[model samples]
Target: MLLIRNLIYWLLVAIVTPLFFLGLFIGAPLPRRTRHVIGESWARLLTWLLWHVVGLRYRVIGAENIVKEPAIICAKHQSGWETLALQEIFPSQVFVAKKELLWIPFFGWGLALTNPITINRSDRANANRLMLEQGTNRKQHGFWISVFPEGTRTRPGVAGKYKLGAARMAKQLDMPLVPVAHNAGEFWPRNAFLKHPGEITLVIGPAIYPRDDVGPEAMTRQAEAWIEARQREIGGVGPFAHPDERKARTA
Candidate 1:
């Protein structure tokens, strides 16, 4: 049954993605707000497909922690799920993604239209410079920036080293840093075919205001502690789980 549902979900993607891409071109030459609305609409459609086609549901805890004003959203990277869900959750936000993603055909063009902060991950120094430079400009224009501190998707029960780019951008811009933790990979394993039907819990922590004396590394450490602790509380299989054991569970 799960396999059938997953097939249906991908079928839906195949049908809808091209249409969304066409809409992107139509919205081109219009204002950035117009393109953003189109992108948000596509995200909402995909989120709905995830629920109806795949039987996956989600609930956001501490949504009130999400302020209306522009701030940095630091979220866990697990599956492709958050990429769609976050767009629906936070409207008119820019994501910090890799430069390679911008080279894709239709999806990449749409992403570029949204004015995301694309970085070449290979060059650490240049990436930081771009994040600080472009991130500040985006924030000044009242756009929220969503960054994945781990940089790439990590399997459930695994935690990646938290990067300090988001923290630095927050401090540089003097914005509130909102940390997010979720176990989405438990249901939607990275690079896996089957997506189990389950209610994913996304917890948003309180805004951490960076102090003048506090540096990015320190601020990131503080956020990392809270996020990792919260991950365990929300049913993350800790590092103690063996690789084979984890694989069997996913299988």
Candidate 2:
């Protein structure tokens, strides 16, 4: 049943993705807001399919934590699910993505229209400079910046080394730093073909306002602690399961 569901889901994605890319191209000459709406509409469609076809669902907690102004969002990287899911949850937003993503055929072409702050990840100094500069510009244009501080996705119950880029960008712009945690990897395991049926919980922690006394390192640490602790609370099986419970079950 899982195999059947996954096969059907992928088939739908394959058919629908290119169609949306065409829409993106048609909307390219329009305002950034129109192009963003076109792009995010695609994300909304895919997330809807995940719930209806794949039986994967999600619920957001602490949504009230999201403020009205443009800010920096630091989210845990778990699976591709968050990429699609966050678009629905947040307002007009752009991601801090690697430049290589703009090279992909249809999907990448569509992403390019979204006006993301694309950086060459290999050069840390250059990337940081560009992130702050472009992030500030985007914020001024009323776009919230979403960053995966881990640089890459990690498995469920595993904590990735949080990078300070998001914190630095927030501090540079004096924007609120919002931390997000979720258990999507538990159901949508990274690079896994089969997406299991489950309800993923995404928690948005309170905004950490940049302080003159708080440096990027300290801000990053605070966000990491909150995200990782929330991950443990929401995690179900595998490493997220209580050690004593697993031991007793094995015994």
lDDT of 1 by residue, 1-251 (tens): 88999999899889988898898898899877778888888888988988888888898999899987898999988888898898877747899989999899877888898879999978987877878899888887788999999989987667899999889999988888999988788778788777778788889999989898999999999899988877776653423233554555566
lDDT to native, each model: 0.84, 0.89
What are the per-residue Cα lDDT tens digits for candidate 2 across 207-250?
Answer: 99999999999999999999988887777643334454345546
Task: Record all residue pairs in model 2 with backbone atoms less than 3 Å apart, i.e. clashing.
Answer: none
TM-score, candidate number 2 = 0.93
Candidate 1 Cα errors over 4 Å, as ranges:
236-251
Among all candidates shown, the one with the greatest lDDT: 2
For all predictions, the C-alpha RMSD in Å is 3.5, 2.4
Clashes of 2: 0
> What are the per-model numbers of colliding residue pairs?
0, 0
